[model samples]
Target chain A: MSSEISSRGPADHDVRDQIVIAATEHFSLYGYSKTTVSDLAKAIGFSKAYIYKFFESKQAIGEMICANCLQDIETEIRTAVNEVDGPSEKLRRLFKASVTASLRLFSDDRKLYEIAASAATEQWQAARDYEVRIKALLQDILLEGRQSGDFERKTPIDETATAIYLVLRPYLNPLLLQHNFDHADEAPTHLSSLVLRSLSP
Target chain B: MSSEISSRGPADHDVRDQIVIAATEHFSLYGYSKTTVSDLAKAIGFSKAYIYKFFESKQAIGEMICANCLQDIETEIRTAVNEVDGPSEKLRRLFKASVTASLRLFSDDRKLYEIAASAATEQWQAARDYEVRIKALLQDILLEGRQSGDFERKTPIDETATAIYLVLRPYLNPLLLQHNFDHADEAPTHLSSLVLRSLSP
Candidate 1:
C-alpha cells in the first residue's frame, strides 16, 4: 500500500469518513487494543487492501478518532467560555467546562477514553497537538484578562498559562483521572477560584 | 504458606528486614515486574514458604519498598521546609524539595519508580496513605501561613490544600511524571510561586 492516501476527491473523502465512523463503532464495541485492522475491514465490508488505501495503520486511524474526540471537547470548552461575560468568569467557565466535558467522555464513552488515554500515555502527536491547542486557548484568555485589567500583569503570560495547564492536567489526563475522579466536579471550582484569586489585579 | 509471621520477637523482625532488603536489591537489579517470589527467595537464600511467612505476596514486598522510597522523599521535603524560616518560604521549599526528591527517584531509581507508578495506578493502600500524609503536610503549612498572617484565610483550608496538592500531583505521581519530566525543575518554581501569590494575605 502507498504511504499516502493518494486520493483527494470528494468520493475519497466520503470513503475516509465512512472508514473512521465504522472503525470508531467497532473500537467502541470491542475496545481499541482488541480490534485489529482486519476486524475493521471486515466490519466495514471492505477488503484489507482497500482500507489500507485510506489509512496507514490501526494507530493512524486511532489518531484521527482521538483528535476528533479532543476537538469536540475543545469546542464545548470554547462555547462555555464564550457564553460567559468577563475574563475571570470565562476562566472559571473554561475550567468547569473542561472537567465536565472530560468526565462526560470518561463516563459515556470509556472505550474511546481508553484510546485517548493511550494516546496521552504514549505521547502521540495527536495528544501533543491537543495540548498545544489547549495551552494556546489558555494564553488567549490570560492575554484578554491582562488587557481588561482583570488579571495581574506581573507574571509572564506563558509561565502562568503553563502553571494553570499543569493544575488542570490531572482532570484532563486519562491516566491520572482515576485518582481524581471523585473530585472532578468540585476540584475545578476550587482550583479555578484559587487561580482567579492569583490572577486578580 | 502462613499469612502471618507468627513471631513478634527481634529475630523475626530481623528476618523480615532481611527479606525486604534482599527483595529490594533483587527488584532494583532485575526490575519489579520481571522478578517473582521464587526468584527473590532464591537470591536471598530463603525458601519460597519462608519468604511468604514474612510477606503475603510479591506486591506486599513492593508496597514496603514503595513506602520506604516515599518516606525518604517526605523526609527530604520536611527537612527542606524545616530549614526555612517563614511559612511562605517553607511552602516554596516544599514544592522544590518534593520535585527534587521525586525526580531523583525517577532518574536514579527507575526500577523502583516502576513499582511506585504501579502502586499509584492500582490505588494501593500505600499510595493512598502517602497522598493523605502529603496533603496533611500541605494543610499544616497553609495553617501556619494563615495564622502568621502570610496567607489569606478566605478559603477553607482543606479545599485550598487539596487544590495545591492537585497542582503538584503531576510532578509527584510517577504515572503522570513521564509527561512532566522535562519541566520537573522549573515547573515547581513557577507553580509554587503561583500558589504562594494566591496565598498572600
Candidate 2:
C-alpha cells in the first residue's frame, strides 16, 4: 500500500493525538511530578498498557505535547512575519501573533505550561533548543530590516534580537495563562518602539 | 529585667537567625509542597513544635523569606538610586542591582524561590500585596525622575513604571527559578539603555 493510504487508514494517529491532548491537560493541571501516566491513560479512556503502544514513556508524551504547542506558535509567527509589508509592520504582527498564540495555548492548557516551567531542570535542553529556534527567527527579521536599511546598525543583530526576546519573555507565557492581557499590552508596544528607535538612523 | 533582656539574649538571637537561614535552604531545596514543619525543624536541629515559636506555619515562614529578600532588594535599589546623579546612571544601576539581586537570591536558593512562587498560589492575597509593594517602589522612582526633569512625558510616569516592571519582571522570582542565571553576562544591555532613552526627553 502507498504510504499515505496505509497511514491514513489506521486509527493509531487519531488515538495518539487524543492521548497527547489529554496528557497536556493533565500535565498542565497537576504539573509533571504530580501527573501520572495511569491518570492520563484513564482520562483518554485507554488502559495503562494501551498507552505504551503509542508513547514510549510519560516524558515522551509530555515532550510531544509541548512540541505540538510550540510548533503551532512557530507557524503562526512565521506566517505573520511573511505576510506583513515592512520591518516595523512585521515586528508588530509577529508580536501580536505571539501574544495571541501564547494566550490561546496557555489558556487552553495552563497547567501544562506551569508543569513544564516547574520541571525546567529536567527539560533544560529542550527549553534551550526552543529558545534558540525563536532567537534565530527574530534574528532573521532583524537582518532583513538591516538589509533594507529600515533599521539602524549600531548593535549586532543577534544581540538586538536577544534583547527583543528578553523584553517579550515575561509577557508571552503570562498573557495566555492569566486574564490580564490588558495589563500586558503596553510592554510589547513599548518594547517594539524602543527596539525600532534604537535601530533608527 | 529590661524589655530587651526579656525578649532575647545573644544566644536566642543566634538560634532565631539560624532557624531562618535553615528554613530558607530547605524551602529552596525541596519547594513548599515537599517541605514540612518537621523537615524545617530537623534541618535546624529544633523540635517541630518549637518552629511555631518563630513562625505560625510553614506558609508564614515562606512569606517571611520572600519579604526579607524583597526588603533587602528594595533597600539596595533605593540606595543605588540615591547615589546616582541622573536618570541614565540611576537606571543602569537599578537594572544591574535588580538582575544581581535576582541571580544572587535565586541562584543561592533555587528551591526556596520555587517554593515561594508556589506559595503565591496558596496565598494569593499575600502575593498580590508583595507585588503592589514592589510596583509602588518602582512608581516612586519614575515619578521622582519625572519631577527632576530627568525623564520625558512620552508616557505617564505610572505607565512607564509599569512597563519597566514588566521588562524587568522575568528576572524576578519565578522566572529566575526557571532559567539558569549563568548567562547573566550575555543578557541584552540595550534593554536598560533603551528603557532609559525612552524615558528621557
Q: What DockQ does every candidate get?
A: 0.45, 0.26
| Cα lDDT, model 1, residue B92 | 91
> TM-score for the first chain of model 2?
0.74
Mind giving the per-residue lDDT tens digits that candidate 2 earns over A65-129? 76666777778888878997888888876676777777776667667666445334465445556
Model 2: per-residue Cα lDDT over B1-201, one tens digit each: 698787877767777677878888777677767888998888888998788877788777777677677677667767876787766677777677766766766667667666556644454444567667767767766777788888776666665777677666655545442453544655525568667656656
Q: In angstroms, how far off is B5's CA in candidate 2?
A: 20
Q: How much does candidate 1 score in TM-score?
A: 0.88
lDDT of 1 by residue, B131-156 (tens): 88889888989989999999999988
Question: What fraction of the native alpha-carbon contacts across the interface, defined at 8 angstroms, is recovered by model 2?
Answer: 0.29
- Cα displacement (Å) at residue A48, model 2: 13
Each model's Cα RMSD: 4.0, 6.3
